[model samples]
Target: MEWQVWLSIAGITLSTFLARSTLLVAGSRLRLPPRVESALRFAPACALAAIVLPDLAYVQGVLQFDLHNARLLAGVVATVFFALTRSMTGTIGLGMCAYWALRYLAGP
Candidate 1:
C-alpha cells in the first residue's frame, strides 16, 4: 500500500521478468553439451523426489517402514507399478490409490 512497498514489488516483478526473458532469448540460440542436457533432464524428477520422499518415508522425524505407514506402502506400490508398467501416470495414480486405501482401511 505504501510507496516503498509498491516500489519493492515492482522491482521484484521487473527483475524476475527480465531474468526469465533474458534466459529465453539466449536459450533460442543456446546448445548445451549432450551430457549436460541429459543431466538437466533428471533435474525435475530428482527435485520432486527430494521434496516428496522425506514426507512419504518419515513420521515425526523418524523413518516409517511398517505396514501402518500408508505413504511407504503407497511408495512400494508405485515403485512396482513403475517397474512393471513404466508409466509415470499409472504409477502416480496407483500410488495415490494405494495410500488412500491403506489410510482408510488400516487407520493411520
Candidate 2:
C-alpha cells in the first residue's frame, strides 16, 4: 500500500536473487582446493543436525523430555541406522516411519 514498503520488498527480492546467483556462478566456475572440498562435504550433515536437533529437544513451544517424546527416540534410532547402513534415504525413511509409529502408539 505504501511506496516505502514496495521499495523495501523490491530491494529484498533483488538482493536475494543476486546473492544466490553469485553463489551459483562462483561455485560452478571456481575450482575449490581439496581442503575446501572436503569441508564442504560435511556441510549437509551439519545443517541437518542443526535443524533436527532443536526440534527433537522441544515441542509445542515448551522444552520436554520423557518416554512420550517420540522424536528423540526416533532420532537415536535413525542415528544408529545411519551409522550401520550409511544410506541417507533409508535412514530418513526409517526415522520418519519410526516417529509416526511411536506418535500413534503414544496417543493420549
Which candidate should be chosen as best, given TM-score against the real structure?
A: 2
Q: Can you give the TM-score per candidate against the true fold? A: 0.53, 0.59
RMSD of each: 4.6, 4.4
Q: Give the alpha carbon lDDT tens digit for every residue of 1-108 in model 2.
A: 599999999999999989778778777777889999899989999989899888898988677777778988898989999999999999999999999999889876
User: Per-residue lDDT tens digits of candidate 1, residues 1-108?
Assistant: 699999999999999989779868777588888999889989999989999889888978899878888888899899889999999999999899988898899854
Scored against the true structure, residue 10 in model 2 reaches a CA lDDT of 97
Model 1 ranges off by over 4 Å: 1-22, 26-41, 59-66
- TM for candidate 2 is 0.59
- What is the alpha-carbon lDDT of model 2 when measured against the actual structure? 0.90
Q: Candidate 2: which pairs clash?
A: none
Best by lDDT: 2
TM-score of the candidate numbered 1? Answer: 0.53
